[model samples]
Target: MPPKRAFDAELQALEALRQATPEEALPHLTKTLTHRNNFLVSKAATLAQHHNLTALAPNLAEAFPRFLADAPKSDPQCWAKNAIAKALAHFEYQDPDLYLIGMRHLQPEPVWGGNEDTAGPLRSTCALALVQCRTINSHKLLLHLIPLLADKELNVRVNAARAIEQTGTDSSALLLRLRAELASDSPELLGACYAGVLSLEGPSAIPWAARFLPPEDDAAAEAAMAIAQTHTPEAVDILKSTHKRARDPWFRKATLSALALTRQQSATDYLLHLIEQDTQTADAREALMLSAPSPETLSRLQQLAPNPNN
Candidate 1:
């Protein structure tokens, strides 16, 4: 089929799937499940999701291993891994605890989104998948991922950090180790260190991050945003005293965002003042929104603005 024609057909089928009554949809969905076409099988899965077709989720699992074991080697393995993640992500939402059993079936698989050569993609994506299973039961995944802290791959370390954040678990030692690595001169290692610490103790990082922040003109702004999570009373004391503070708006913006995360209610007035000073910038607008006063606090922001015309 011509590309557009095939797409049009798929869209029509999807619309029909969406419109079908649950009773009517189940049998057609069952027929589609037998389809060898990858396109149809996944579309059926999506329809199953839209209709809350809980019964079909397990049936869909019948084809999942093929979707994994059959991945052609020449193509990037990440695509297959990501498909597995998407499938598992949707299914686990139906029964959160099923993830423990499901993950055991999926482990040691290839990484979905990380660099392919190293184990980064597999480890990182696995960690993320486990994290998504949080709604099902995070403790199981948390127990499984803890040992990964000793994983030699820096990318794995970064992702494991994300997993910990999603689970809201503690990893003070790993975070401190990452914080210590922030002193390294190597940018990649330093980037990994910063990425790892952003979730658990963003404020605790101020002391270490202040020393290693790249020059404003360098392309390390994203890393700076990640690293800035460590800014806090324990960390930002360093930011407050940094010697060559960069002229970059983003770097400054990251620092301010971190500061806002501290919830220093006393600093609310200062934060509100800064947001007003840069009404046109999205970062400022976001920081203002984040700092919204609680029931105990009054509305400090007076400027009601629309989203920028991005």
Candidate 2:
């Protein structure tokens, strides 16, 4: 029972964490997990997991049961189960009971609240939780997730596809079929489904993801990102070429950013080369700033700077 009006202050603190580095925010987030309020604890768990604070795993694991026990009999606005499941998933918790309960509780359509979107977060997160189940066999998790592909909520269906992807299931055929369905029904889901295929098939997904790139459609930026995320040698070459050839500055910048996300030596070298050239330095520098700057980049920036003695 945190003091009344704590939720507002808690929310503000959470927002501040977005700007704060993980190192700076971990202490506050850890303290928040010990708070009595369910919503605050759930939020802290989510923040910790998002920051990849593995040190907080034991705390999150202990907190999950308490959060579950405190869950409202009816669906509440500050639902904790979804957040808890998200945190636990990051820690690779292997509790089958949690997964089973999540699967069982999922409704194809919203059963609570006046709006139909209310249940999407919970059901979708449950699908995500299945993907993170470490102790269970992948096949078993697959069995639980496959049915969710047909869920009415886009979030649930997309997450289910992602879960299947995480299970290393050969879901190319299913993914293609779902892509076609999403093409007609829900365009937003198509990107995630394609990403799932990439995760499952790796280079095999290049052809499909590439179709979304320039001259064929308006999804070139997105395709560039998806391809870059693969972090394969082929992806690196493709991204470099895409950045060079793209006429759209936004598209070129997107490709550069994607390349930076890979954080590979070759990618960093390419960016460094771009920054030395007059034609592309501005955009390359911007993207490099957005990336996790490497030691080489720091050294280069220093060399490029004017000496105070001069």
Candidate 3:
């Protein structure tokens, strides 16, 4: 059969299995997990995860390394391996060894100018999974995760920071703070690190994060937004203070936007006060709308800045 036709047929079969009873689907799903076609294997693995089929855990585990053997040819974009790893993680399969192998796997596939590592997603999935393993101590987990913070892929680095955050130890928070200090580029990575520290240390780390809120860089913007996500009274006050001190128009606007995201009554009140001003009104309204304000807040917005269209 043509590859497309074969793929279509396999998909239809998987869909049918999805609608079948778990008992009826089990054998077929298990067989499909071993299919040579990566797409088919991915679909089967997703179905297993969807069904919570704990019985297929070993099958998924076995299939992961098969595609990793000659990854570009067998798994292409690491599709099969990524899916299988996710399924095992969903099962909460507690083998740090499997996750460690995947977390370190780098599949550099041919692209136009150069090769891009297709296994970044697989590494990210495995990093998150590795943290969840009950057998590994926090120190070992952080040791494994720290290298990923400097991974070639931005998403891999970001998720490594997030996985570190999940460890929730003072050591993990310190690792994040250290990464935040050393990272000069990639605001998203900095944002993840900032969020991790704030999450692990709570409001007290607010002062440390606030230090990054000056100089009007993307890192500063990330800091502002991270601070805003805390949604504490302290967060609101710090953002309010930052907004007042900001000289750059873009940074000032960014601060207002961050304030809206706080979802605090005080932040809402500050934004409402800004809406009354001629210069700040449009930016403030745009910020509130983007925040997805509560109904009462929306009503207040409608009153103050009556939509010309309405």
- Number of the predicted model whose lDDT against the real structure is largest: 3
Model 2, residue pairs in steric clash: none
Candidate 1's residue-wise lDDT over 216-301, tens digit each?
42225435445435434543344433312546676666555654554555334445555556632466457646755564333445
> Model 1 lDDT vs. the true structure?
0.53
lDDT for each residue of candidate 2 in 101-185, tens digit (9 for 90 to 100): 7654532223566444444677777677766666777767777876777777777777776667777766544654466344643
Predictions in order: lDDT: 0.53, 0.69, 0.91
Residue-level lDDT of model 3, residues 105-160, one tens digit each, is 99888999998888999999999999889999999999999899879899999999
Model 2 off-target regions past 4 Å?
1-73, 78-80, 83-101, 104-116, 132-147, 150-154, 172-188, 215-218, 301-310
C-alpha lDDT (0 to 100) for residue 129 of candidate 3: 96
Instruction: Give the number of the best model, judged by TM-score.
Output: 3
Which has the better TM-score: candidate 1, or candidate 2?
2
TM of each candidate vs. truth: 0.54, 0.61, 0.95
What RMSD does each model have against the real structure?
7.7, 8.1, 1.5
Where is model 1 more than 4 Å wrong at Cα?
A: 1-11, 21-23, 73-84, 93-126, 131-160, 167-176, 179-198, 201-250, 253-268, 271-310
Compared with the true structure, model 1 gives a TM-score of: 0.54
Q: Given candidate 1, what's the lDDT at residue 102?
A: 34
Question: How do the candidates rank by lDDT, highest first?
Answer: 3, 2, 1
